[model samples]
Target: MPKVVLVGERELRDLVPLDRAALDAVRGAFLALASGRVIMPPILSMAMPEVHGEVDVKTAFVPGLDGFAVKISPGFFDNPARGLPSVNGLMVVLSATTGLVEAVFLDNGWLTDVRTAAAGAVAADALARPDARIATVFGAGTQARLQMQALALVRDLDEIRVWARDSVKAAACAADIEAATGVRTRAVGEPRAAVSGADIVVTTTPSSAPILFAGWLAPGQHVTAMGSDADTKCELDPAILARADRLVVDSLAQSRRLGELRAGVAAGAIAADAAVDELGSVLAGTAPGRPGPDAVTVCDLTGTGAQDTAIAALARARADAAGAGLATDL
Candidate 1:
């Protein structure tokens, strides 16, 4: 039996933060995905509608990496009422050469949150205008707050706007972000008002219906829809996809099945076989990103297994270097 390291959330948090290095790790994952050397499969998900919960299992194998990761994430919307968190999960890293478990991260979804936020930052960095200063985010949840913080890492944001169904939560979220990022932040009652004059707009809600309409978008704006990671969720109107000057997705196959593109194709707003660009391709310079300053671009991120593998690999490397975590042979 090989020795396996068990790392908890506290250590993982200290190891992998939503910083430049974390962003770089996620960026490398995208680059590897674009290089066609990564082996990532479709997400395995199970819906527990009775409890209003769902669990997703994702993993990927990246070339040149010593190990890969498998992550199991669960989201229970009603858990808050029971004094429990809505999201929680863990990750297991396996040695690529030996096919043995190398480490288990009992992060309880902390790594997922960090990597997801990093992906948003990477998408914004690659697609948003270099001079982007204003950002609007929909949803007053953990992801909404993290997305704003992540965006600040790559862009010099002058202001941030938050809009959610619950006005009080939205306001509170805004205040927290302002205090954390030291950027002017406010809560907007109207969703359109929140998006108006914003250079970058991110939707982070798990809305089943569209929250952002096509008419609300303007030129020179970049939209990142990170909420629609399932077939049942949609944040942007289907027409938004048709109107975007450039449409990019984390994965074309995943987007077509789970992201906004699914709704776009179903509504006949976009061609089912349209030639869309992947975010990895854009980052790799193989595909264009932001045709011009005035072009409207949209990137739909349904999340990816490659990110899990990347972040997990980083965490393990950091733990090894710092002599952290508990090693056990089983």
Candidate 2:
């Protein structure tokens, strides 16, 4: 029998914050993905359309890590109406040497939120102009607020504008970001008004249709699309990919099947065999990012199993150091 540790969300939040350490962990994951022979498979997704819900199973085995993580994430969109969160899940860490369960993170999706936002920050840091200031985010959900906080970690943001279908929620989200980051933040009624003139634009919605159009983009602007992780969801117009000077994705294979690139290819806005750069390759300097200040760049993030493994490993190590969680032998 192996000893297994169980850590809850409240403790995990204190252990892994959305700070430089968390950012570095995710960044290192991308670097390892690019430079090492990591074993990460395609996402296993099950759609429960009858209940407006979906579950995704993701995992990865990095070469140097002592353990790997298998995460099960479920999103029930209608849960909010029932006084429940829309997203919740846990991660199971297994020993690399013995393949036995070492720990279970009952983070309830907090880890995913942190890592996803960190990935967005990494993309903006790598692709956005060094002097990028203003930012616009579409969607007022958890990711919208976290993305702004994460961007504040890497970029010297001056202003953040939020736009959502529900204007009231957008205003609340804007107020929260301003208070949290001390950056001037506001809510706008028009999506175009939110996108125009922003140096970095991030779409964090679970919108099924296009909320960001191609014509709204400007040169020298960078876009991070993190919402289109499912085949049915799309935030950016397919034409936006066609118009980007440099396009990047977390995983080319996943993007082709589940990210915005799928819509682009289906709409013929981008080539089926387009030369797209992976975020890891860009971070590793194997591929180019933002060729010049005037270039328009876009990064499509469909989320990845490597991130779960990375964050989980970090949480487990930190918990051990802090003497957190409950250990039991079975």
Off by over 4 Å in 2: none
> What would the per-residue lDDT of candidate 2 be over residues 179-282, giving only the tens digit for each residue?
98999999999999899999999999888889999999999999999999988888889999989999999988889998999989988999999989899999
TM-score for each prediction? 0.98, 0.98
The CA lDDT of each predicted structure is 0.94, 0.94
Clash count per candidate: 0, 0
48-118 in candidate 1: lDDT tens per residue? Answer: 99989999999999999999999999999899999989899999999999989999999999999989999
> Which portions of model 1 miss their true places by more than 4 Å?
none
Per-residue lDDT, model 2, residue 256, is 95
